[model samples]
Target: MSNLPTINTDTIWAILQDKISDEVVNQLVWSCLGYIYDETKQAWDISKVVDDWGEKYPEPPDFIANRPPTVKLTRSIPQENKQLLKEKLGFKGYKLGEFGPRETRRATAANWLLSYLETH
Candidate 1:
């Protein structure tokens, strides 16, 4: 994986939804996707990315920048902290434990989305 801080959209699909909150997934996905598209001169669909990601994220957050977002959920977010996470990443579609296909705390959330959200 490219580790230049500019995460590729294709590389971040699974990272987007894997047992994470919608806020974290969206931010990380968008930030990485932004690098792939806007920074590295690649072309892709943000709307489709978001949609393909899952219905949990009805839409990307309003604070998104023209460039990818800088806040990375994994590295930055502490482990096993619900309220703090809610304050930071927002508790939109959060769940406990590892997620399963067609079986999750949040029924609307998609397990495959994270896997497909990546570009490369």
Candidate 2:
């Protein structure tokens, strides 16, 4: 047998018994507990799944109406760097101010400038 301790059916029963009563089908209760045990080796998996996801993708710095806000440039790009960025954008057929790609947002523009500075 696997070294993992056997998930107790009785423990699953004890917790489930209160949530379900005589009116509910007995098979449904057992099936629910069995499915939970098979998936998580425990009587419930919601909290475990939440904890796992939290570790994988943590919360952002802040939220607005329960949603993360759009990213922005963190600091002002210097005049010289800005001029260089405009030249770089001009080479790529992007004007940045008077006429630029509609798809370019503040974060993307800042990233492009930083990437250019890094390479050159």
Candidate 3:
């Protein structure tokens, strides 16, 4: 029982227009929600699971709450899909100097896309 915000999968489905699979979307959203997959065990790694926050604790922890929502596209999604998302979402400034390093640009674009989808 964590206090992290839940993503609306319906919104993702609508935005992706069936270009990406539902399973991959689930994996991306779950990763963003702090669940990591353990390949050797072939299951979720829950050792680092956060404790249930009581009703009084209404928000996620600072580390999660402070940052913009982002998916680790490098690890969870294919590079081709990442590029497709950038193109579809009209993300600019993806070059090295245009928006920091490669990873930063990708992450920024991902965050931007997420925010866009969630809002509209």
Candidate 4:
């Protein structure tokens, strides 16, 4: 059988704790999903904003630009990786019912990562 890549929870936790905040992660999730925070409306809305990896679109705004280059920003985690993270991190669903309305998988994952860092 082939060897599987190892995940270092301690290192991942440390990065989450030291490099980024839950709020910023949430914003990054939205950015990855093609949404932008409208300061005037005080809400997130669908926009043409591009992520760091988007070469065809315009440059990322400050909210996305200011993030540490090492942070992994994506629209969604692949199923296998998500399962691996859940198993290693000992967490449940990405949905956070206590926080109110349901969020996208990406947002929920971001929120969960931050929550895990905060509580653990």
Encode model 3's per-residue lDDT on 1-120: one tens digit a residue: 244233453444342343433344444444554455577877666444333321212222222222332333233344445453446555453456644333353343344346534444
Model 3 / residue 92 / CA error / Å: 22
The digit string of per-residue lDDT tens for model 4 on 86-108 reads 56666454444543222333334
My TM-score estimates for the predictions, one after another, are 0.21, 0.23, 0.31, 0.31
Write one digit per residue (lDDT tens) for candidate 1, span 1-120. Answer: 133323333323333344444444444445543322344644433554432322333334322221212222222223433233234333344355655432232221122222223213
lDDT of 2 by residue, 68-107 (tens): 2213221233444544333543334334575422223322
Off by over 4 Å in 3: 1-14, 49-113, 116-120
lDDT for model 4 = 0.40
Displacement of the residue 90 alpha carbon in candidate 2, Å: 3.3
User: Candidate 1, which ten residues in sequence have the lowest lDDT sum?
Assistant: 105-114
